[model samples]
Target: MASIFTKIVKGEIPCYKIAEDDNYLAFLDVNPNAKGHTLCIPKQEINKIFDMEEDHYLGLMQFSRKIAKALEKTINCKRVGVAVVGLEVPHVHVHLIPLHDMDDMRFQRKVSLAQEEFEAIAKEISKNL
Candidate 1:
C-alpha cells in the first residue's frame, strides 16, 4: 500500500508544495505545528530513515536543510526545528517546524491553517528557496 506522502508525490493527492527535486519533495503540512511547518520526504518510499543508503540519507538531509533555510527566511519564528518520527506514517519524512518556543516541538499541539494560508506559506517558502 502507498503511504499518504507517496500519494502526494505521485500526484494522487494535492499538496501545498514548497520545493521538489528528482529525489525529494517538500510541502507545507496541512495540520501544522507552527505556521510554515513543512515535510521533506524522499521521492522513493523508505520505511525508516536509517534504512536509507548513506548517500540517499545524506541527500535527504541536504535537501531538508535547504527547505529549513527557506523556512527560516519566510517565517518569523526564532529558528526552524527538525524532527523525524516515522511512527505516524510508514514513509520517511523530516519535519521542519518554525519554533517560537519549546512547545513548538511537541506533537501535542496542532495548528490549523486555511487553504489560502497554506498556499501563501508554501509560496513564500518556495520563493525563499
Candidate 2:
C-alpha cells in the first residue's frame, strides 16, 4: 500500500498545494498548528528522513527552506519552526509551522480553518514562492 503522502502526490488524494517540483511537493497541512503550517516531502515516499540519500536529504531541506520563507511572508508569525516526527505517517515529512510563540510548535494544540481559507492561504504562499 502507498503512504498517504504518495497518494497525494499521485493525485489519489486531494491537497491544498503550495509548490511542487519533479522531486518534491509542498502543501498546507489540513490539520495545522498554525494558519500557514505546511508539509514538505519528497515524492519518492521514503519512510524515514535519515534513510534518504545525502543529496535527497539536502534537497528536502533546501525545498523546505523555500517554503518556510514563503510561509514567513504569507503568514503572520515571529518565525517558521520546523519539525520532523515520522511516527504519525510512514513518510519523510518536514513540518513548516508559523510560530507566534513556543506553544505553536507543540502539536498538542491545533488550529482549524475552513476550506476557502485553506485555498486562499495556499494561494498566498504559492504566490510568495
Candidate 3:
C-alpha cells in the first residue's frame, strides 16, 4: 500500500506544496502546529529515518534544512523547530514548525488553517526558498 506521503507525491491527493526536488517534497501541514508548520518527506517511501541509506538520509536533511531556512524567512516566529516522530504514518517525515515558545513544538497543541491560508503560506515559503 502507498503511504499518504507517496499518494501526495504521486498526485493521488492534493497538497499545499512548499518545495520539491527529484528525491524530496515539502508541503504545509493541514493540521499545523503554527502558521508555517510544514512536513518534509522523501519521495521514496521509507518506513524509518534510520532505515534510509546514509546519502538518502542526508539528502532529506539537506532538503529539510532548505525548507526550514525559508520558513524562518517567511514566517513571523522566533525560529523553526524540527521533529521526527514517524508513529502515525508508516513513511518517514520531518516536521518543520515555526516556534513562538516551548508549547509551539509540543504536539498537544495544533492550529487550523483555511484552504486559502494554507495555499498562501505554502506559496510564501516557496517564494523564500
Candidate 4:
C-alpha cells in the first residue's frame, strides 16, 4: 500500500505544491505549525530518513535546502527551522518551518488556513524557487 505522501506524489491526493524535481516534492502542510510550514519528501516513499542510502539522504537534504531558501523569501519570519520526526507519517519528511519564536517548531501549536490561502502561499513560494 502506498503512503499518503506517495499518494500525493502520484496525484491520488491533492497538495498545495511549492516545488518539485525528479527525486523530491515540496508542499504546504495542511495542518501547519506556522502559516508557511512546508514538508519536503522523496518522490519514492522511504519510511525512515536514516534508512535511506547515504546519497539518497543527502539528496533529500539538498532538495529541502532549496525549498527552505524559497520559504525564507516568501514568508515573514525570524528564520526557517528544519525538523525530521518521522513518527507522524510513515514517509520520511523534512519540515521547513518559518519561525518567529521557539513555539513555531514545537508541533504543539498549529495554524488554520483556507484553501485559497493555501493556494496563494504555495504559488508565492513556487515563484521564489
Query: What would the TM-score be for candidate 1 when compared with the true structure?
Result: 0.99
How high is each candidate's TM-score?
0.99, 0.99, 0.98, 0.98
Candidate 3 residue 67 C-alpha distance from true site, Å = 0.4
Task: Evaluate all candidate structures by whole-model CA lDDT and list the values in order.
Answer: 0.95, 0.96, 0.95, 0.96
lDDT (10s digit) by residue, model 2, range 15-102 = 9999999999999999999998999999998999999999999999999999999999999899999999999989999999999999
Off by over 4 Å in 3: none
Which pairs clash in model 1?
A: none
| All models, RMSD in angstroms | 0.5, 0.5, 0.6, 0.6
Q: For model 3, what is the error of residue 49's alpha carbon versus the real structure, in angstroms, after optimal superposition?
A: 0.1
- RMSD (CA, Å), candidate 4 to true, equals 0.6
* Tens-digit per-residue lDDT, 34-128, candidate 1: 99999999999999999999999999999999999999999999999999999999999999999999999998899988899999999999999
Worst 10-residue lDDT window, candidate 4: 42-51
lDDT of 4 by residue, 67-99 (tens): 999999999999999999999899999999999
Task: Tell how far residue 123 is off in model 4, in angstroms.
Answer: 0.4
